[model samples]
Target: MRATAEPAIAVTRQLGRFIATSSWLDIPVDVRREARRTLVHWIACAIGGSTHDTVERAVRAQLAMSNHGNARLFGRRERLVPASAALVNGIASHVLDFDDTQLGATNVHPTGPVASALFALAEIRPLSGAALAHALVLGIEVECRLANAVFRHANRGWHVTGAVGSLGAAAACAKALALEEQQIAFALGTAATQVVGLREMFGSMCKSLHTGRAADNGLTAAMLAAEGYTSADAAVEGPQGYAQVLNGATDLAGVVGALGQRYEISRLSYKPYACGVVMHPTIEACLRAREARPDLSARATAITLRVHPDVLSATGKQSPRTGLETKFSVYHAAAVALVHGIAGEDAFSDAMAVDPHVSAVRGRVRAQPDEAVRKDEVHATFSLPGETIEEHIDHVVGSVTRPMTDADLERKFESLAGEVLGASRCGRLLERCRGFEEISDAREVLAAATA
Candidate 1:
């Protein structure tokens, strides 16, 4: 009777090696299909967010920094360095605060890292739709697995997208390059050194900067590894390594377990509101209540929101005065939803935040955390003229249970794309995204989106 041995660190390293080089033929059909969907969604987000001042500024600034390279800028005609382009485009995709969100991993935005890396590589390698699709799947798996491994650790203070996403981004870049298993491992180890971000800066520009830095670091890691740059093989598991020094709990075994079989990216939730995901349900509840009784919110004495503890961490402003601040204010979001009966991108503008009526109501609104409401759901109650009406939203529109309809997604695209390309180009871009998987040339999709 011999005792069985536990899986070694070598096994985890092997899994990382396998993931970086796995091709379309290696993954299942369903994973491949889901990958295409994720890519289309990522493109949609980038196109929609291109109109943001921050995104536009960042892209323009990066363009000035480097004049060489062939990587395509989202919603623009010029090309920049692969790494720089990814950083700018990744930030643009998330700059407006409208992007895909994973339910299980509250703070991880998959497209920011994966799409950023893939598009950067695609410009250089001219990857096929199938190859590009597979890369996205592999990238997503890496991001989500790292997300799972570090989410609890992230909850303590680490920004997983910054810390773990750098590694994911490198993994994606290695896949796109079709690197050898050993090279891929080297890339991962190189990426490990660059992982860094703090959740304390969630409400400001630095929040999105995390995504940008991760995108840049990840691509740089792969490119450096490809050129024979070296990193410690024990980058993840060694004492003072990624798991120990950075996150304090990286769960290497969990990250590598079921590497090819389980897919975590397909479970992500799309966002309807261009604000923090935590505030979405509260915004929706206010909208519903307003529609049900319009006058109630108009004359409300006070409003109260019951939400999970993370809301305050993600988007809770006790007293906010600016438009950018409103994006992270549940009170302001609720006020906008009630006053305008919607929480679109316009609702988060500085003008709207300072509106007499919105400000008046926002002053009276209060938010408190409740153990009963999960981080993804919320319970909001409005105290109006005659009564206190309550609504508990388990799933907001664009969330898993109440997913956004095609029409809803189109509406979001129209609002953002219209700001830059005008109505004609916007309409064409939306059409291409709906049928993106069938396209043979990735340029067709990019051209249609930026036209």
Candidate 2:
């Protein structure tokens, strides 16, 4: 008789145990702080992007399918079923491309998927802020580890956020359900089979939809597992599993080795600019150049940015026609930053993308990919009539090495959420997020965010 294939090592089960057993108290003080920051940033992005045409259409679509339910959308008056809410909120959170990034091919917008699912599930049943925080931390820990494992080796064009997000979202939802190891493992497996996202979708509304789908599907997987649904426990590591098929490799060892001991959520960073995280350093260089020469944009004949090789691959759009496309254009980000001294939501608008002054500078801007350049660092030179001005960044703002302060995050929340919710109500929501762990019902935060 032919020998049968042995089961893959217990990668899914181990992660399940870690997530299942983890509690709010088990999270270190610093990790908890980071979790709150993640919430603040994610809520800000969701509320801010909530007004975007992409989010509006998505909400309209969801509303048409089912007009009324319990779960709340960030900045809208409408309510949706939990899964639909997760999908819509996830899309709104990421529609601005301002959501947090894990910095790599794993552009895993850590909390957008996990927290979106968690918050949506919170509405289905009462969950404490503490539980929300704990689940968020553990879920992201699972997500970054899984995304990191396959993203590097995965086929180019696979967006890691869409590929591994459902896995993390499932973990968080499973944790919220307080499922034991077997059920949690099943949830992970079911989610792993649902991976979706394409790098080709980067410059379109579909990019935000990827995150929405991840949140929706991940929540469905966990709820199914909670109801005794079954799936291959070795889905992440089996011979023809997610890893092998998606990337041909799985870091089973790394996935489980540091769980609980080291928290991945702490590594998450917020964004200062509303664009791809890789373009931040380049924008920083441009801003610095402009600051040094107040008339930099007016005088600089040509601008060149030297960034990590991945920058070009990720944000290489030299000429873009819309706001969403500009988020993936290093050239545009640099040009706009220099010309307007702004990188806020207004800077990447369709009108801004086609602005005469911005377009003129954008065309002259060039990005040279360098293997030696780090993702958080960039080099730039500005051509002047008689001399050249240069700027080099050791580390960009909002990077882990230079994290945004709590106050900075609050201001960001105020800025984004204020416009949508109005100043008074937005301030209340900001306060709720800042004191998230102290709240009794996590859904209160959602209730507070709606206009």
Q: Scored by CA lDDT, what does every candidate get?
A: 0.75, 0.88
List, residue by residue over 69-128, the lDDT tens digit for candidate 1: 677778777678888878877877877778888763556787787778777777766766
Report residue 367 deviation for candidate 1 (angstroms): 1.6
Per-candidate TM equals 0.91, 0.97
Q: lDDT per residue, candidate 2, 17-91, as tens digits?
A: 888777678889999989888999999999998889998898889889987788898898889999999999999
- List runs of model 2 lying over 4 Å from the truth: 1-8, 153-155
* Candidate 1 backbone overlaps, count: 0
